[model samples]
Target: MKAVLFKVGLVLCVLLSACSNSVDDSIDPETADDDLEGPISRPTSGYGVDGVYKVAELSFPNTEYPGTQVTIFYPQGTTSGRPTIFYAHPYGGEDKEYNRGLFEFIAKKGYVVVFVPYPTTDISIDHRYLTLWTGFTKAATDYPNIIDTKKVGFMGHSFGGGASIGLAYKAFTEKGWGQDGRLLFTMAPWYSYQISPAQLLNFPSNTKMVVQVYDEDKFNDHRLAIDIFKNIGIANAEKDFYYLKSSTVANYRYGTDHNLPNSRSAYDAYDYYGVYRILDALMDYSFNGNEAGKNIALGNGSTAQVTMPGYKNELMAPLEVTDNPSPKYTQSKYLFPCSSQENPRIANCN
Candidate 1:
């Protein structure tokens, strides 16, 4: 595939709009029924070491059967409370292996991670929104001591990355962050989903971080993710995009058709470092309340240090095209709720 620049550009425009409007959200249908549902089913197999402990077969009560299940990876010994993160899996994947390596790495740094496995077979945006909100809320309330309810972070890959953005929107609009606030981080987000500009506009003005790993993914995902973040930044939205050139998060990027995965060595050396940088940034902001200052101290050099030829072209071409809208919000799964008969116009979700 040469590149899908135009589609990428269109996505940026849609997301920019979401940053401006207030999202209209209701109680996640899955959580409407009250019950302290337990964890989902455990993972059949995975690796965990030292401070890291992996627990699979955890289930959460949902509209679906056996409840929506997921996994948890965190430090083995935490004498005190630890920051909690709700980790969403990548799209088209059955488990959390897409982020397993990174999740375990973060766990060692002193944090609890809830690896959520959404019903991927039914990975519609709305379904994800409901599952994520319900699951996260359940974890916060049920495991208060383990999960610092006041400090929460969301990280996801691909479609899961997109879900992280939506979760941020919900957290902010619903005042879920009122006590201590929350952080939103997305890795290699699938920006093609058709959410409206109104729905996409709010994040830039709030707290968020998006990390894009450049590789050979179709839909020009890397460049498109950068374009989306740049628009948020230009709009003076509160967020930054950490760009990694030619370093796939895992060897699987190009190993498959998308060519986005990196080698195990690259994943450990480069990809893990990128995640470390982001986690450090987040920890500083949440604990120190000086994210901007921390970035300044670390120096922007580390933030955007990847040096790759043709990188500028890869970033600009797609941005140039996406600035204009084509597929539009109508194509996205986000349903702009209906209005009164007298006012047939439905307000944009932004």
Candidate 2:
């Protein structure tokens, strides 16, 4: 009887100890949202992750350009004058699958996201540019309440990035778009055409622009991005030349390449901090007059903009930011060399 009682007591003690440890291991629900100093597996704060507003999607036929389509996402039953963003996709990225998460993220945040996909097959760059422009203008006119034309942003990737420059130029010169507030977020852009360096000077000094380049990018040379940064008329204060660096944590790695921005293929911390966080802050600063967002968006090497918190209390590599980027033009290893492209409009290629 004594032996049985001792065995039972040992079992009970083990169970009680496990229960106590379990409670200790569990995260405290109340303080879970606070910033953690130690190892973390996932992002705790969903800054630009999801927003208050519910997303409502609309697709307008490309009346101006028949073969294309324009998709717009906005907050459901929202008020008028929502800050609008015109997004152009990368080359061959003719479907919303390329950036649907980002589009929904913006729309849910009470902003309008206009995604205009241009033709890649059997179409010239000029045709693609025109198609995007016409589709954008049509969407704005059709949904006047949803899209606030006065406060606008032009964002794109690769070929679309290059086109954003020309499109912003046309919109500003002709329609006074962004006279209220304008921002340009270009990522891994190719050789820009349809606008000259002199014409680049035509951009409003107040316009805010961020030219993002990836260190691992081998398609578009950094010189291409640097040239645009130098020639753009926006003052050094408003325009930023941003460079993303690749990071690794143990066995995992975050890529800083041309495809890193594409949320569909691979989504990771870089997308949240490097791309979404930066752009979200930028839009807020440029559109809604949010002064605090300026520290994160165009901080120009400020700690808020450069710091990218990662897992395991690890600080991801800081983004290289500056007004003037002196890229080594001779050291380019881009797959599409400047000399190889036939487009004569790219200023630096020749």
Candidate 3:
């Protein structure tokens, strides 16, 4: 009887082991593959490609704005019909070398990047806006064969951020340039002029705007980004407000400050990993028409959703025509020299 009991126990153990194997084999192949693959990497807190294409830098005298210079970053071996981006430098930052990392990264991504340096002496807000618009127009005209004018995008930091908005307004209302689709990305945008809520509504419906805010920014707080985002009237357009959270990464000590967007001042965790990821995804989605990029921008999944632990985001859903009416403006005003009286250099007045 003892021998029979031992044999029965051994058989039961074997059957149990076989049942476990059968259950493992029954898993769906696709589900098993996904389990092995793991979650998609998020761009919110990581760096992107490091110079995929060789870059060629060229400088040209701006005929539109005398004494001003326009620098072009052309990717070598790039064929004709590439997307273009107009980058406006922040006030007191006329030297492109200060932000070389950002510019080169964008160029390596296959977009023709034009950097416009305005006169640091002249603190005229309107003049800066005009210079940016003129520089972009000139770049597009000069490199018509290389730049796809229809796929133009604008980017800027600080005062240049305000100028980007102004340029977008001109491009949409007066110039009718970015009707096909335009991208406007502003980093820590300063309030140069008193932009009314109605004026903000004038942005083109097809325009995609991304406003970035540094959480620890003392000079220009996140409120400025919120205000700008609130006033945007493009109900049918894609818009997002991103807040770069302060980093606690080991040895990465720089908080998300006002100057964090500039390569000269940005920390590696924020610049390469954080800001670069956002810019890369934006360009991919807006210019390259990559669906993955759009998902990232919208915080759907992948890099977009995987930000730092403390980072937060807000998105503006596309508005329906029946729910949100089209924007109309009777008079377009160009406010001049909107710099603060205290500093006279910074564009922020309030």
RMSD of each: 14.1, 16.2, 21.3
Q: Can you give the TM-score per candidate against the true fold? A: 0.58, 0.84, 0.70
Select the stronger candidate by TM-score from 2 and 3: 2
> What is the Cα-based lDDT of residue 293 in candidate 3?
72
Write one digit per residue (lDDT tens) for candidate 2, span 1-350.
23432453354234323320022222223422322122323244434445556678889787545766689988777658688999987765677866776887687567898988765543466777888898899888878888889999999887788889989888878888888889999998876878877889778776888899898887677777777888788888787889888877555677786776765555666776788888888888898778777877888899878877766566678888998787644535875455544444444653
lDDT of 3 by residue, 106-187 (tens): 7766677888887544545566676777778877777766677777788887667766776767666766665556788888
After superposition, candidate 2 runs with Cα above 4 Å error: 1-49, 63-68, 328-332, 340-350
Please identify model 3 stretches exceeding 4 Å from their true place: 1-47, 63-68, 192-196, 300-303, 309-350
Model 3, residue pairs in steric clash:
42-303, 43-303, 46-273, 47-273, 235-319
RMSD of 1: 14.1
Please report the candidate that would top lDDT against the real structure.
2
Per-residue lDDT of model 1, residues 1-350, tens digit only? 11232343345334323311111231122212111111111111211111223322234554331454655555554434467777765544434554455665556545678766555445345666677677777766666566765667776766666667667666655645524645666666654243445656545343545445333344323433544455442232334555443322222221212212322222332332334444545655654476453452123343232221122233211101122222222312221111212111223212
Stretch of 10 with least lDDT, candidate 2: 19-28
In terms of TM-score, the best-performing candidate is 2
